[model samples]
Target: MNRCLSTLAKLDEEGYSAPALARLADRRAFPPRLEFTRADIMEIRTRTAAHMSISGVQEKISLRLHRGKLQPVTEDGEYILKPIPGLALPRFQEDVPANENLTMQLAEQIYGIHTAPNACIRLANSELAYITRRFDRRRDGTRVAQEDFCQLMGKTPESAGPLYKYGASYEELGQALRKYCSAYPVELEKLFRQIVFNYAVANGDAHLKNFSLQQTATFGDYVLTPAYDLLCTKLHLPEESRLAIDLFAEDEEPESIATYGFVTGADLLDLASRFGLIEQRARTILNDICDHRDKARDLIARSFLSDEAKVVYQAIFDERLRALEIRG
Candidate 1:
């Protein structure tokens, strides 16, 4: 199928977007014949699902909105919708959608980072689904050239070895922006804030592919894609390190490393300083993140996560925020 027109979605009252807010309010009322039950989604996975071509083993379906109704399609789509994965642990599975939805919302609304516009909607069976707009595709049906850090760094199993995406430090990404971005000084700060946000929220999965450079027709130069795929992985993987990958390129000084792959605010400041950012600017960003706890907690409570999961999410966030602030 040919996706000939770009989808136009409306910004929600809360700064997120979904098919319902744009023109499909009927989805909520009508029970979405176009939507699926979890079992139906699993069956579709066996049918040309690979043709949809996005990565991550999570159960996602490409969707096209025709005349205010959404239908699953392998091509010419505007949104990527995810149902709760059957593989997630039974105890924590219900929180996954809200965990992700709230984190992406928190990134944009509180931290001022641009993120893929998203919201939680329901399937016909009333199962929760997370839907996010496709930022890399234009309304005219042309794909914007976007490259993840893995591709930009020329990484592969042969070149960088297996698990290459997680093998490098985020500091390498900073080094890359310096080399490729025409406006590094400005974009550099955005990247810095994102890293800080990821740490504060306890996301242990911000690997190379989650960060990307996208070309915009207006600017004619590459800048960061709206951040997506953010969540508190710590809730599920309680044993996981505070970060998925290292934040620094060189070895940390003797005092820099903290517990559990954690780093200090000073460590983050040092990271910024190494990248030509001054100590004061680094401190400003780090402190701003730490100081936003009340707002962060508010968002958590308002999220779709179960009450217990919200408490756990907040606790993980508090633990990490304190870790960063304690070093100040």
Candidate 2:
């Protein structure tokens, strides 16, 4: 077995120890983790393609996984398999587990309100393992037309400057959002709930790359995919930041979407109203979120995160709820 893989196995067998992992991380420039060999990468690609019929996988987005030679199984007609990076080990670093756990918790909370792709497995070879369901696949080997918010704004990840640049006022984007909601009323309502949930959880990283539109032949139109990559970064990052392109105009904050372009309470209500949700239903949803604070906290603790990470996670939840003035 590879040294990194062996170490990871030992760590997993013994259970996660934050102090030990921290020390190990300090000792090496790179995290003491395994890397998938070319053979492993090919095998994964072949297997995924065989099972799902994904034909091409690109090394876009983050280079970490691509470096491991693991391509996204785009040919898979049903799901996408995100191979774990060899160098990315599973440790309590930056509260990643907490983030993932939070995704699952939020999924359950908004059960009918939001739709997220399933997280099938958490693989651990030498480093962190993430196996998420592919939302861009169909039953047959066909490609789904999709566009990230960034692409719509003519920006790549590297070119993405300030969130405010791709402000919500872009007439095209506004029209797209309006059209998507008009056609998919049910899905749009769920998405609106997800936006509110992100704010309540203090997910300051909800930027354009995080949102996307899926085009399908059945509807012969484009619509937003179920929510994915939901992590509360407010607790992990500095203060007074958000992951929205606009503020207040859409939800509840007094700021204009063009000004302080973070998703706020004002944005949520605005979206709800657009989706035909009355004040009473919208308020009820907000109240339900406030009531689930304790639940979110408990779920954080239960996730595969260190105790300290849990505390940090919970604190963010508390702070965000208070900031939103959400009452249980």
Candidate 3:
């Protein structure tokens, strides 16, 4: 019997399980095979690029789950579909979708980070694509007011230059959250845990545009939106920067990050201090994050990454864990 790629459950001839299908939509059958080809997706991407608010090198098309089947749409999309990109020349491009799917699942299932609902689905060519239901959209198709850190900081390519999004520190994001979010202490801890999780998984692309705040039911209140774009970028872009942004701003680095030249548990404790957390609370978070090695490895084993990719992925994971240098 084969394993269901979507849920990683034992399959009884049906490729997806009831729970996995339900995750896509209540009582939904396996999404009907996409009517368009990858080439069709490229053409649509070209025509729709100006209209889409989401940004990245990978090609993505807005989709809506209509009447139990997924269909591509140019407007008011309830889900976002990302096929293996044709650009940027990343290594092991075929594994990119599964890499993202596995990383997102690890964040949500293992570390308990709130992530956008996501899964791996088959493209028309039998290739895999990453799909996530849009958290900013409601069942009735209204848009939620959400703003990424870049926007919150009033940054743009023109204002801050080409690498604008990468120019800041995670500490700046924490400060921004403090000013905007009414529930600062609680959300700050969530942000700290997310940063630790990103390091653990080697998601080096967690930039300003990747984190956001969404308006809540209280009219003016805001909170961190569910995590999106979570992935092990090191697997694809091995030679790229270790992190999209510095863990701390200049003049704020602890001796550990300054001397050792990478993040250590000490540096994280310093960051938590900068975020106004007490030392003991920070250590507890770090210890808790460090204790999840076996669970992460088990999920990696069950993921859909190719055998070669899986080995590289685990190697990256182990190396990042060592770099963290968690203490007693």
Q: Give the poorly placed runs of model 2, Cα more than 4 Å off.
A: 1-94, 109-113, 120-127, 151-166, 169-175, 180-184, 248-267, 270-277, 326-328
lDDT of 3 by residue, 192-227 (tens): 989988887889889999999999866669999999
lDDT of every model, 2 decimals: 0.76, 0.50, 0.82
Residue 200's lDDT within candidate 2 is 70
Minimal lDDT window, size 10, model 1: 1-10
Instruction: Residues 1-328, candidate 1: write the lDDT tens digits.
Output: 2110111123232222344344323233322334567788778766858688877878888876777567778888777878888785635787787788889878877888988867676667867677777887887879999998988988877998888878678788899988878888888999999998999888889988788998878988988888989998888888887777787777444255635345777778877976888778888888888888888887777777778998889998998888788554
> Candidate 3's error at 296, in angstroms?
1.0
C-alpha lDDT of residue 173 in model 2: 42
lDDT computed for candidate 2 = 0.50
Q: How many collisions between residues are there in candidate 3?
A: 0
RMSD of each: 5.7, 10.5, 2.0
- Writing each residue's lDDT as its tens digit, candidate 2 over 295-316 gives 5665565554457767777777
Best by lDDT: 3
Candidate 1: deviation at residue 285, Å? 1.1
- How far out, in Å, is residue 58 in model 2? 14
Between candidates 1 and 2, the one scoring higher on lDDT is 1
